[model samples]
Target: MVVWNNSDTMEPTFILRAFPGLEYVHSWLFIPFCLAYLLALSGNVTILSVIGTESSLHQPMYYFLSMLALTDLGMSLSTLPTMLAVLCLDAREIRASACYVQLFFIHTFTFLESSVLLAMAFDRFVAICHPLHYTTILTNSVTGKIGLACLLRSLGVVLPTPLLLRHYRYCHVNVLSHAFCLHQDVLKLSCSDARINSVYGLCIIIATVGMDSAFILLSYVLILKAVLGIASREERLKALNTCVSHICVVLIFFVPVIGVSMVHRFGKHLSPVVHILMADIYLLLPPVLNPIVYSVRTKQIRLGIVHKFGLRRRL
Candidate 1:
């Protein structure tokens, strides 16, 4: 097992373990890791730039896309330094303070993403269910308020985690299973009683992500009812098609999160490698895939991307 570089002091340090039994191949792992990281960064930046430049894309739905892209960028960058350092340079040690900061950004971005998805679902709901009132309901000022509310909600929920964690004492070897710090992973290393931390964490997840997901489902349910009321089959298909990209984004974000939760809850018998890999997927996959999904599924985004890349004439 990897060991911590320092003793368990007031300000402890933790070692970030990459794939177990693959230390010799750690350097080689950088190739795929860097590629994925770069892909995530470039993809999200392209999404943001396209949305910014395309005047026609300045509506509520695209505004929400920009928010998601920004969240992805924040998430990807949060894990980049430690991941690269651990994989390429064998610099596995991280101070508790820095770890807490990373944990803050990761969780904050995660909750923010969930909230943004909920907002997008509302966008779809308005567009399909109340077509005549969509513009009236989701004006530029209203959308900005919605985005600000999401940010404040995520911040309010996650700001206390690090402070709460500071009260716990670490007696276990402070080696994290993954390259980056997570709230649960950090909580596991606490020697002090952490029932409160665990409970608080669970409660916030249930309140924020859990509730957001439920509301998103409710919105879609209402949207389906609205769509089915449409007399024309073609019109129904068109309305449903508008939601495909958001649905795909939701799945990619939540499925891996569910996988990670299940692994933590029931997969104690599994290898540490399983936990680490699952965490990485939960962190990296959505950012890398969200832009690709939107670019392919939403014609406006696809056209913007093609024009930005100067591929409009060729393709």
Candidate 2:
């Protein structure tokens, strides 16, 4: 029942809600949100700097880590402007074109992160399971190709979403669920028939996130099998330890994603706060926690950090 007045000159502007039902508390939430942005920015930048400057750490693992840091940085930056505008300036208005641009980058970086994580999992599998052939398998050229492939795949898939949205004339209130533009959130506001959008969205999720998660799980299963074959308990522990940081990050990324997906599909009658919180967690937590997890769990990264900050002992 969409009232389609398709005029090219009449572009709709969207109102971004900081937190739909919790507008009164947005001021209080701003402090933590700002702090999280700062921490995520500083932490991921630090990881990149440490990896970039340290020659000893220029391996396939650190290369993938750098890619993860880049994605985290992109993800944080994609939402920072609108988030601040909504919370601080109360500037909730965003034009359709700008909104689509933001949506493209946010979704692009999101899928890119998943792709990088899958690449890292494969890196780990090779490092642990095929130690003798690790270098031959993940050479710098191959690694670059992998990174480029991830970027190209993400861009190609996400680019169509905004184009598809552009054709639809929106006649609803245009109130966004969170501080930023999301595909599903915006689609719901369209008065036009959205079956194609919905189906394409689901297809992207299944093709990208779903496939990546399944492959990551498969890589770990194979990794575990290889680890068990090691005769020495100490060797087995060392082998499994390498995957701990990646596992932590995977959980941080996927758990919130699952929560957001579930809420989107099943929790329509639920409070807006639940939906907002899940989106925030999915968008914010990985950037904030990924560096911390890597620094704490990866000894080389920890040492690189200490040395970078001149905190390493002279002894």
Q: Candidate 2, residues 46-146: lDDT per residue as tens digits? A: 99999999999999899999999999999999999999888877888898899999999999999999999999999999999999999999999999999
lDDT of 1 at 161: 93
| Lowest summed lDDT window (length 10), candidate 1 | 1-10
> Candidate 2: where is the Cα deviation over 4 Å?
1-8, 312-315
Alpha-carbon local distance difference test for all models = 0.93, 0.92
Candidate 1, residue 117: the lDDT equals 96
* Model 1: how far residue 160 lies from native, Å: 0.6
**Top model number, lDDT:** 1
What value of lDDT does candidate 2 attain over all alpha carbons?
0.92
